[model samples]
Target: MPIRTEIVSQDRIVYQGDADMVVLPGIDGVMGILPNHSPVLTALQYGIITVRLKGEEYYFTVAGGFVEVQPDQVTVLADAAENVAEIDVARAEAAKTRAEEMLKEGIPSDQDRYLMIQAALRRSTLRIDAVRRYQQGRRSRG
Candidate 1:
């Protein structure tokens, strides 16, 4: 049995479909969810979310959120989420560069600000990496 999954961001629903499996970037580590898995409600980290459906895989870059898992469904309420297909490579690159520069300069005076910047850097990096990996996969397959 496939698990019903929905990923929602602040602006819109990022994805909604039935997936055979889902791998989420959890706070502790990656967590894989399958059909009939035990119930869980956990905080997610900035990283990639992989969904497998009908033998095909979909990738998304998710920036921190909470995931709730039931016996039959999984829901991701993300701070921000973008599909690999929708990602603009140039924009992601620019954001990554900006984040890197900010990190280099250091926001050490404020712990909260420093951590927030670090998270942004991580999100940007994950997006760039995801897009490149998707493009590479397409090229290899085609």
Candidate 2:
């Protein structure tokens, strides 16, 4: 069975289609959804959403949001999202490095800097995952 998915952002819909399964980055952790799963709504985390469609894998990086599963239909109201194909690996790598430096310097003792660093790390990880997936797709295609 297939589940309908809709990935949304404030500006537009990132994706919508039928998928065999969806792997989400939940606030608590990652979770997989399939057809006939129990209904529930939960908050999202910065991470990857993997979709299995027609035997091919697709990946999207979502920066937090909400997820609603109603029967076989799963909808994700993502705060921000980008497909793997859209990621800029160099930028993501730089962000990751900066976040690591901030984490090490401990300048967040007074500011939200620490929290922002954590957020940057999450975003960087999401981008890295997306880039890896895209590269894997390229390799598989070739």
Model 1 lDDT tens row, 14-104: 8898889999999989999999999999999888888888878888889989999998999999999888778887887888888788889
- Give one digit per residue, the lDDT tens place, for model 2 in 22-133: 8999988899999888998999988788888788887788999999998879999988887777678999999999899878876678567677788789889878877875
- In angstroms, give how far residue 13 of model 1 lies from its true place: 0.6
Which stretches in model 1 have alpha-carbon errors above 4 Å?
105-113, 137-142
- Against the reference, the lDDT scores of all candidates come to 0.86, 0.83
Best-fitting candidate, scored by TM-score: 1
Which pairs of residues collide in model 2? none
Q: What is the alpha-carbon RMSD of candidate 1 to the true structure?
A: 3.5
For model 2, state the Cα shift of residue 26 in Å.
2.7
- What TM-score does structure 2 among the candidates reach? 0.78
Candidate 1's error at 74, in angstroms? 0.4
